[model samples]
Target: MLNRRQLITSLALSATVLALPAPGLAQPAPTTRIVVPFAAGGPIDVTARILAEAVKGTLGTVIVENRPGAGGNIGVGAVAKAAPDGLTLGIATTASHGINPWLFSKLPYDPAKDFAAVTQMLRVPNVLVMNADAAQRLNINSLADLITYAKANPAKLNYGSGGTGSAGHLAGEMFKNQAGIFALHIPYNGGNPAQLGLLSGQVDFNFDNLATAAPNIRSGKLKALAVTTTQRAAAMPDVPAISDTLPGFEIDTWWGLVVPAGTPVETVRKLNAAFTEALRSPEVKARFATLMAEPAPSTPEQFDAFMARERTKYERVVKLSGAKVD
Candidate 1:
């Protein structure tokens, strides 16, 4: 019923109002991706999923994607090449960040240069476990006993590890150097095989992840000599640390959150805040306990420094062990 001019004016005002966003309403956040460089259901993937859930309130919508391959190079490389908008992040690990730089001659991504460390998520201590029967047969009841036996026997005592350049292999190399014992190195296809070999007495001992070795240790199939962490693991408080006898001897699996290097400092700080908060939560603590992992959240500066030290340590171990993937 209005005149043409009035109708036009009303229509224009209505369009303008529709175009403006509501005063208090916020736009939906884009989904953030945590690229886990491992297969689904593995420890790293599980950790990423847990973190994704923990940070949901702060990060809005976060998802975990598994892009495992090439000893985590493919997935990590994907993160390295991703747009530095903080939308894509990575779960960088000891393997990807610490050892791979030296192990793989032609690494797909530069661990130090391509990513900004947000915070260290957790550490999974590796235990030196001997087959129960072998331990009993050799009279090796503790780390001291094993080191003494190896020193006396020299190259006669053999240890199995997850391939030549694996974390286990590097840990073994460090152990030999620190303990001054000579044990033959037997490389297996992977961790499972290495553990299997140790269980069957194919090898005398193994530097195995605490989570996978805990059940066997409880069942008396494997005798835990010591954890490789500087301190004893919470899940197995009775066990001693290798560092207890060989001070400065520390080799453990660890992982943390990282974003592309070019991401703005503001975005990096925001991510670090969210992830460190999640790592400090009691729910995350309990969940990590179930995995036999210890949360080790740290500031961006601390994480970068930690990674630098880790890489330097691995450089020595890898060279001494002569481990190569090229």
Candidate 2:
């Protein structure tokens, strides 16, 4: 359990970590692995890699292993079932850490009780886009146009989601629920494949992160429709926000670090310090700037609170979306 004092304390909590007897805790050559729940090249993996490299000097030899599957539940479940040792950590993302709890009827791991929060890393807004040619044909230059089209041709229009219970999927579902529209959903193996489906004309639209869609949008392969964030992102200032079309429609993905539940209190403190320090580094900040995501460092307590709020928010969205694991 997190104490208010511990949550509000801004001091480097890592210094207080007890040096548990790991294989190389004393040696300078210890290795640590950070498991990313999503596939490589996504925001979660990208941020984990960047932070891992930045903290390698302080946290020993850092490595990232991708175990993407089941809308990120498989990788996250791995962390949940892993030993509560300091060596095995996980990159917690919105789909895995936040939304899945509400979406899945029987999750292998409890999002609130089965993991230890380390530090909050970054928050990214999702981009809504369509293939350029499709955009031109539909004349759907804005979010308003898309909504109108969906309303006019409910069953004919559809959107792509990373998977049945993924963040992008839920964001689209939430949009449909809020706007009173019905768009067919086409789930893919991952965001990359979902984006590909949209690009190849297999799907009409996709809601994904700016980092994933930026290149396509810039190259005129995909046209930017709107961002799921309430405010316009610095990376795409000219694009309108989903909130602009439907008020109170904000659904951004947040990422963080966590360990298996029951990790020694001291180890959690040490890991938090390494992550917080990593977030403050110039290199990590530069990477976040490029991704159009902001690094948000928080105490273990604050991370816990953030996850709680996310759990509540996504529960409503999930129930509305009628999501379930297969």
Candidate 3:
């Protein structure tokens, strides 16, 4: 009943309708929850917020949830029990994945079995910082100088840490073991207090997170002797690494993303891609610089392997230090 042009128009309309996706067939928008297993204001929480902001464009409705307590086990356990639909993810730190297993007598979730690695997010170096005045008095300008002074004074020099078995505590112990030097260890309730002790000269030095100590170091309140990492930190390139003096000495905190195990491989890949891309973006990189951290994106497989190595390393350190908690 129609002319040739009209018939062709009808056919085209039919084809277009057929090509359109059905309402229920289209993919629904995803709401992802990123759980941080630490207090809200700490480095891990800040990193989570930054990552949430960075990936919002690619992954819709990203949110960061803070669950602090029991040295990060409580929140991490919640993530382990989360639905493996890729909607629930968590930030895994060296403390959570590497240290806690050995530090604690029991954990609600197994770090190795409960979650699948999404990607490694960042790495933050620890710096050995001393009171500027104390360093000046001791004539200590480098790790070698610090070592020389500590060796000469044996137990006269004392270090402070957030607590027993913390990264700082372990780092100090490791240094003692590696350098064959002895110094007293003073534990504070938290890193801030430990750093305060260092500033007040209550303690001789601290293995402080570079981000937290950068301002003080810049302000000349604290003198950075060496970064705990084997390599110098980008945030403080002028500071040498402790390994330069004591070979094989390295201790730094790192964070990564993980999802509950049994998450679809495709979903994990998508998450890895989104986060890695976000980490690679200039804005995120700049922000990490401010935090004295480096964006270290990696594949799921790579992250898994890295965590395994970290666990083994921390186990040895914990054993060596005899650090244990209930």
Candidate 4:
């Protein structure tokens, strides 16, 4: 009954109306699982649990699952291959996201390509600690003293770390190369065992996480030589920076979140906003403080850039140390 032009207009309008979402459109409830690529009580694990608690209200129910193996590769690879529906996410670190690819001959997932950058969570210094008795025996109270002792003893001095390609190992190797010392490297399955090795005097020293090493350092069971940060850590104000002795020596482990690549931009933004807000919460702040980690926040883009820089830095360190995963 209508003219040709009117008929076409009516048909077009009907199609557009059909395409539009219904009024009061309901979005599916958010159910998120945060994957930590390390064992419980480790740096990445601690941070992930803190974030999980903080973001629970925002994400409906935030859960943390540990899938530790291959120096955090197993858990990270799981997230990389997960659905990009804002449900499964990963709490990534230098080992899982930056250092693993270059150190391993082949990685299960592409660090840069397989995941979406969420936000930089926190940064913690690497502490150089020695057994209480060993510290006294070697007369090593500071970085200078350690260097002097190492130079005199050469290969007699040894250190332990989490694993071959871990940040702690690379940091110790850098210290050895820069200071021109010949300290033996003793690699262990994890930081706890490495710390035990140091405590038992099986190893002369260890470059360990501030979170993991703080209690031992505080208890006077171990002597703090220095921290691997550009500036002295607020938690260990008396301890000097390693850079003080070895110029340009700065290696700090960092943690952040990443989602599967190709996730919707809106979802990424939502996650970034929620997580960043949670990072600023008072409870999380206190938790990080107790763990000797400096609470850090960054935009998604900033986190991406940080990861890139970390990858380059660790790549060079791995080459210098001749480090590879066993």
Each candidate's lDDT (Cα)? 0.94, 0.86, 0.93, 0.88
Candidate 4, residue 145: the lDDT equals 93
The residue ranges of model 1 lying beyond 4 angstroms of the native Cα positions read 1-24
After the best TM-score superposition of candidate 3, give how far the Cα of residue 54 lies from its true spot, in angstroms. Answer: 1.7
Q: Give the distance in Å from residue 313's predicted Cα in candidate 4 to where it truly belongs.
A: 0.8
**Model 1 C-alpha lDDT versus the unseen true structure:** 0.94
lDDT, model 4, position 109? 95
lDDT of 3 by residue, 1-326 (tens): 99999999999999999988887785758789999988898778888999999998899889999888898999999999999999999988899999999999999899999999999999999999999999999999888998888889888898999999999999999999999899888999999999999999999999999999999999999999999988999889999999998888889999999999999999999999999999999999998888889999999999999999999999999999899999
Candidate 4 accuracy as TM-score:
0.87
Model 4 lDDT tens row, 116-206:
9989999988889889899898777789999998888778888999888778899988898899998989999877899999988999899
Best by TM-score: 1
In the range 24-74, model 2's lDDT, one tens digit per residue, is 456566689999987898667878889888998788799999998876789
Q: What is the C-alpha RMSD of each candidate to the true structure, in Å?
A: 2.9, 12.1, 6.9, 7.3
List ranges where model 4 is wrong by over 4 Å. 1-28
State the number of backbone clashes in model 4: 0
Colliding pairs, model 2: none
Candidate 1 residues 31-80, lDDT tens each? 99999999999999999999999999999999999999999999999999
